[model samples]
Target: MAISSTLRSMGLIGRCFVHPIFDYLVIGGGLSLIVIPAVYLLADPPVMRDFTMLPWFILCSNSAHFAASTVRLYTKPGSRDALPFLTMVFPTVTLGVLTLCMFEADVIGRYVQLIYLSWSPYHYAAQAYGLAVMYCVRSGCELTQNQKRFLWWIAILPFFKVLLVATSKHVVAWHIPEQLVWSQVDWRGGVNLVTEVLGVLAMALPLVLFAQVWLTNRRSMPLISLLVIMTNGVWFVVFPLIDGFVWTTIFHGIQYLAIVMIFHVRDRVARPENKRGVVFHTICFYGMCLVLGYALFNCLPYGYQMLGFGAAESVLLVIAAINIHHFIVDGYIWKLGRGDANRRVVETVAIGTGA
Candidate 1:
């Protein structure tokens, strides 16, 4: 009887803004990254390299997630009035930059691709931090400024580690003549050691902070929040580079799609003018994202290929351009300021869920 009572209390502590299953499995990446890995480890399932080749998986993730934020921005009522510059000018500017990259594929395109790759880890870290704090606030787990600062470092430390290792080689290459890129190699070992230390700290600090928060606040952050932080750490630091990119893009897409859909539907339904049901809005929003994604990732690149760009370069440049645009747009659209509609929607959702 005591064990049963204790287990029930433990379960109640982990309550999420969404239902437990959906929030943990989808938004937190637990099912894909954590559960699947444990299953593979215990059962020793046959390793398949072509899992990403599935057609439905291809259509629903990656590019679809990138398209989601754009869909969210334009679909929200008053978006143009609220964010005139982003809604009006950014798309045209993005297209112009993409055209320049297409014309100078070797020079400008390379730099753009490099920027996307470099920025990706930091982007992931920021997403992790944002979602973690959102869950904390929504769950009524008040965090002091000191606690929030600790959480921020816990979220961002992985990015610092990734950045250090990534730039160490390139920093030397950038400063020296082209031919000396190969010869400059001595500094990497020390940087690698430093990153290794950072990696350990990044992996350890989250658990430490989680315990500290619980002790200090008399309430824990939602378990889903911790799952988010851990999953991001695994993506950047624990997984092999090739595997990390493949998995993170797909799973991160899943995470982004789930949260954005929730916010979009909630916002739409709450408006007095909205005549659409949640089901209708969800289907419509995701359907538009799918079509736009197909056009952006497939049709645009194929068009560039037909116009004489190298097929691989065409694909990569388009991806980089799209990603940079998404990163910039996401910066503005999700702000939680007093005037922002997102804050209202988020607070409403939290209250509705009894979070």
Candidate 2:
């Protein structure tokens, strides 16, 4: 209690961890991205083994948060305005078929995994960018068109490097040793050369973007924004391939839960359209995520195995397929257009008209 009181008295920099910036950058995914590896690096051998697999497995199974958010977005009345039945229905069927194809044909499954793995980095980066912009505006930063573009591109650049390098033989994620590179394009230089060049650009461009942010003063970069973006770069360096996947997914889940829950609560309170009481709705939202998370993340894979898809292989494919589905569903849902549920969610994070 004394320790927490000392912490509370530390003011904005300290308190920001729990408040306006919490969902946007600090605790949700961003802090864990740092703390997990720090502890893992400091632990002894036996402790390290516990760090290796168990935490990651638990985290991976917690993907129910993503499902919970996605389910709410779709389940809400009139969400279909932002996303049509065709958009939602087609991907559901197609991804399911693709999952089945993985059992039947190796090539199809590999591509499915490839797309999901490749998209994961970009997805993380994009979420960081969104939260960064929200916090930037909330904290009184005013961004012009060019400045926003620079920030956007810089936020995306690191993850883009992941996607580009992933096109060649390199660390993918999970148990897989190599990511799929496109077979068709023959570079005048070797593929390694292309990846090397991209890497350099990725490193240099963000610095340039930051300089521009400083120079123009159109919008000051929020401290939270910097932390969020920096965490992305550091996270990859700390855990390049294997444990990286687990840590990132967990962080992503926490981040998603924080922001989505905020939106859910806000929507329930602010909108007359909502019929359920705030406390009931909030409890239901979290309860669904906790229960559904296990079912989707743990049970679904076992269900696949029970159907004789080969336990090990089917579990892998099930995860890959679910991730792909999450990506597709999420990609369409978060646009900040005119009146709709998604717009409301994004608006809740805005200070003014958004930086």
Candidate 3:
């Protein structure tokens, strides 16, 4: 509900490190201004890249980050209030049934997979939009009702366009079956034309929005707000689908983790029952995610295979189900508006100082 700096008596060096926007990006988003352009231009070096997926650390870590953040929502008290049964039952049923279908019914499996891919960018953009507005309000960039409405429209359009692009081009051969295609009228000419134009607009909108925000708020508008919104451009507009899966997703997870953990730590500290220290709580939080991630990623496949499910289909189904659950949970948990209790989770303050 209120924005305050996180800086304390650690002086100028401390100020640089302690600021909310800086900490948010560095710790949560896993990026800074310096890292973005370098990443855009850089490729994986010739040497072995990092961990499981090779050529990148992101591949191994992203799923855990996402699962961990979703688990954070469950642990947060707000989720229990906002229609607890739908939050608990819907995703569990979806995952269970879909996993069965993946093994038994190929047509349904493909459909579910397509839906997940189609919905992913919007889910991603939503997080960026929420964070952007939070930063905007924190910095006191007040806008008229219409202006705020337009801001959301701007945040949404790029991902929406990217969805169209996906539909036009269709999924790659390896990711899905030929039956899963979106029947493009003309693969090269008309479809490419539409996709290219959409791609250009998706890339351009964030920059346009950046200019508009600056014109509207001048120096008072936090640069971090603009940067958070533009992160969507990097994710949806710039990279190819597979590479974007690794690069953009990890950053998104980092951004989500940083903010959610802040909420968790704050809430934990506030509760009388929470006797554990921050370090212990942090480990417990992330450790749960890692365990869940392994189960979702590895255990699902093996368990399904043992149960006579198709290995590839089972993996895809489990991944989609968890992601769909995440999207649903996040929609409830981070519904930022006036008088929302979730607002309590993200309130900013001077680090080491009370509100």
Candidate 4:
């Protein structure tokens, strides 16, 4: 009888947790599960051969996102105006380009494809969600100033990741294998310099904006935001300058874990009544931390080659894990926001006042 009751309660929880607009959690989680194993399997090959498999994983993951967005569009047309359309459209277009470039014959083409695939899709998706959250703030969603600040920080984290990877590559040139250093010069002519400068600008822009927001709205910041800022400060600012790739990657992984935990806390606060939502967020939060922890512990110190894996293969696995967690959390919050909007509309109509 106790077991039966437990099963029934679980069933009820699952039903209540069903999202009509987008099965983002399932899609993201499923693709991540598949992509991780596929990457591991494909990693045991020649460098070129291993690199060849990355687009397939990226294509699959991006395709899942595109499908989820399409379903979201169809189910809730009203919510379309809330997010930036370019966020979705650009990823679709870029993913298409990446798909084509994966098959290209030239080495340079593959490198370009890898860079875009690394940063663009998630960058845009985070931006879209950030835009949605900002809309919530504008519409009086009750988010603390700190929450807004944290979301803004996350929205621009990709730029930091790019800069950190590039700078680390340069600063650790002596430790890196001779063959792995593709570009010799720090700043080159034309496109290379442009890309480098843009990277620096992108990384710097978020810090400037974060400082401005904090200064303008210091009183509104939440404890979680403060913690996130401190954690990110240590990883992005303090540690990277002191350590090289091994320690930096480990610390960066910890920072990423903190971000996930902080967001989970925010999501819970945003919808305390939704127990199932809380459970889902908790599952994703811990699950991501577990997976990433395992990867960093087993994969980083050894290096991709030491694990008998190519760089592209290792990147694909790590990215799949991180992106999947991000997608699930973002989708969960978007659905929560939609539900909140509907409740507000009902309340306003019944009360006969917008307030």
lDDT by candidate, in order shown: 0.78, 0.61, 0.62, 0.39
Tens-digit lDDT string for candidate 2 (92-154): 795568566756656566666667778888888787777666555545455678877777786
lDDT per residue (tens digit) for residues 129-204 in model 4: 3433432332233445665555665545534554545543233433564345536643335535554554454445
lDDT of 1 by residue, 1-355 (tens): 5754443344334546467888988988886776557746876433434454655676698788999989989987678998999999999999887877788887666577767887777788889888888777676666799988888898988778766765532333345654554356666678778988887887888889888876666556677778898888887677655566667777889899988988888888888998989999889889999999989988999888898988877899999999999999888788877767778765764564533
**Number of clashes in model 1?**
0
In candidate 1, stretches whose alpha carbon ends up further than 4 angstroms from where it belongs are 1-15, 35-52, 168-187, 349-355
Kindly give the stretch of ten consecutive residues in candidate 4 with the minimal lDDT sum: 20-29
The TM-score obtained by model 4 is: 0.33
Q: Model 3: which ten-residue window has the lowest total lDDT?
A: 7-16
TM for every model, in the order presented, reads: 0.87, 0.74, 0.77, 0.33
The regions of model 2 sitting more than 4 angstroms off are 1-21, 24-30, 44-61, 75-77, 86-88, 163-211, 273-280, 345-355
Residue 348 local lDDT, model 2 = 51
Model 3 lDDT tens row, 217-306: 442345555566666666666667655555567677667766666667767776789788888877777778777777777687788778
Give lDDT: candidate 1, residue 345. 67
**In terms of lDDT, which candidate is stronger, 1 or 3?**
1
Q: How would you order the candidates by TM-score, starting with the best?
A: 1, 3, 2, 4
lDDT of 1 at 194: 91
- Which one wins on TM-score? 1
Model 3 spans > 4 angstroms off: 1-24, 27-60, 168-219, 337-341, 348-355
